[model samples]
Target: MDIRWIFDGKFFVLDGIDGFSARTSTRLASDEEIKIDAYLKQVHSAHVFVIDDPEVMPRGEIEGDGLITDIPAIAIGVRTADCYPIFLMDIKGRTAAILHAGWRGSYKGIVKRALEILFEQFGISPGDTVAAFGPGICGNCYEVGEELMEFFPPEFFRRRNGKLFLDLFEFNRKILEENGIEWIVPPPACTYEDDRLYSYRRRKDKSRLISTVEILPS
Candidate 1:
């Protein structure tokens, strides 16, 4: 239920509590301040959408895994159960982005692709951007298939008791750091371990936690 701030407090990032799903609504409660102005259909793809006009305010109609916008008051978000909800913001607080990075999206390079879009569309450089990860299945709990070993580097995978686990946080962090981004904030909690957040891998819950970020209105 606690809210976290990032980007030198110019922006606030929130990870939703259990039972509240963005698939049903944007605000966790009617009084919630960080109301999501736009969210995606979230197909677990690496595709990202650029929101430039306010008329396209609530864009849940779009099918993509990532969203970026410079417009203040327009909170963009993504829903996740065990997948990581990654947040991105520029140093000057001029732009913000949210990505839904499941194994499929991450393997397809969602983080790297979002960074490229930030530079190509908004002229925001990775060096000027800071990132924060929301609660997700931790490396210790995320068991995976052997085929993943073929896609991700060996360092991201762990073998224990004949099972393979993937460190999604570290995998995404490598992409972030390799692209020149620094000041990464680790997740506050692990979804699968922390009962406060929803986790599909743990309970097979149909509900998801919505993670959102908004540039404070200037």
Candidate 2:
């Protein structure tokens, strides 16, 4: 529970708990398991989760990147090492969502889809939103292949030294902005370059990914 609380008067984020969730990763200690029968997570997949069933949740499926729920007592989570973790809230911060944006998730436009779903499903528009970009690989350390650079939708990667670095912050920002979400808070820290967060690129062998959570105000 090494959490960092970052909020802007209204929205708050609980960051830095990596749950090697929905995978058989060996980096997680046995004791670190959170047997949350009621909590739901996307497990880094691109699918979205909505808590429609009150029948206690099962071990979440391995597909989903964004989770939004207005249901009480149901918590959502997203895991990331070098990938981006985003928390978005609407309803004046009464309802919230946890987002996962790894390179794959980003390529799938999962965050954008999540925004659309929010508008369609919850009647929330990006104009009524505020976002927090938690710890992740910044543009400096997220070097990737030309193949990856081309995979993104032109606004993803920035070139430097004839090499490309993935700017998850910028890419996601563009997506949010296009969808009407204009307010965003970005950190000056890079997960791969900082010791505060685990980075897959920094220590490929094993690193602690950062997980962020937001509890909607009651």
Candidate 3:
């Protein structure tokens, strides 16, 4: 369990040691310290949902890749196995978001869509935003096919010994910087290489790791 303070709230990154069930492991790992109020069905799309009221928001029923909220004590989360889990926070505005950034979701601009929601709904600017990335398959371990070349720019792809790899962190970082988000916490361990974490690409596992964020009660 990795916990940090962001947006004056708890941001947790749970590994796959106990099990991949978010409901079970996440609560147990955190010792019931935090509760995930909202999450998504995650269809690898750019769709983002705004949670103005957690009491009314559906959990795990909506099909989207990202979730944003400004409400206090209401945690938002995303599940991933190898794909990146991105946490976005507007420190000054007390808003936070969690994104499930898989290849399809990233190619579809999930990060951009989340940022748009922060600005449009909360009036939070990019300069006031900060980002943190959880475990994911690193570029060195994330080999991709030539078909991806049609979606991502050349800079995102790298060739090593005739094989191509994609850097999802850099891809999303570029989008954030281009929009004026300068504070980005460098990504941590690689899910594919780290056995403690879950990796669908490495083992075709159905289980997932859950990363959540919330606004602390004021």
Candidate 4:
């Protein structure tokens, strides 16, 4: 597990790992090294869940693209191969979440929905949160069809010799900024461009990178 810890504490991003797809809960259940429980992630369909909801807390795996929690020591994770993984945290509110924001999910407003939940459920304001857009396919490598291109903002698309590429980072950043979240950490790597990271477009396999966020117990 080539994991990199970021975000000033327990948040982690699994990097350079080939062919490892341990389900979020499965890893947490088997983990003896870390003292935190994990929330299983179900991604890519544009769903969102509040971990405190009576409806969400008992599930072994959440059927959503996003998960948020104020629960201490319970880590929320999102898995991605070519899609973006967004980590959101409100330090003073002691709340955090991770979202799987692929083109489809982004078009469906996953980040906006997650922000709404944080503000409504945890009394967190957008300015109070800091976020990180983790490694994924970069615009230079992410060519898309017109159908997909039609949903994005003009600035998020690049045309090269009539081929269109989608800038996933800029697309999500626009959404975050529109929602009043200005403190976002940009992606450090591109999955398609960097062989050290796994990418669906590059690998055509089940291999994925897991990004997680955990608030320490008080």
Q: Tens-digit lDDT track for model 2 on 74-161?
A: 5566556778778776635445677778888887887877787788888887777766677778877789888885677666667888
* Model 2 clashing-pair count: 2
Question: For every model shown, what is its TM-score relative to the native structure?
Answer: 0.85, 0.76, 0.85, 0.79
Off by over 4 Å in 3: 1-34
Q: Report the lDDT of model 4 for residue 217.
A: 62
The parts of candidate 1 lying over 4 Å away from their true place are: 1-34
Clashing pairs in 4: none
Highest lDDT scorer: 1
Worst 10 residues of 4 by lDDT: 19-28
How do the residues 127-148 of candidate 1 rate in per-residue lDDT, one tens digit apiece?
7777778778999999998988
Per-residue C-alpha lDDT of model 4 across residues 1-218, encoded as one tens digit per residue: 22332332222443322222111221222234333345445646667777774344524454788887777656666767878888787857378888888998988888888888888877898887777778778889998998975688788999999898999888888888998997777776777886656788987847667666676565
Q: What residue pairs are clashing in model 3?
A: none
As a whole number from 0 to 100, the lDDT of residue 169 in candidate 2 is 84
By TM-score: ranked, best first: 1, 3, 4, 2
Kindly report which residue pairs in candidate 2 clash with one another.
45-64, 47-64
Candidate 1's TM-score = 0.85
What local lDDT score does residue 175 receive in model 1, on the 0 to 100 scale? 91
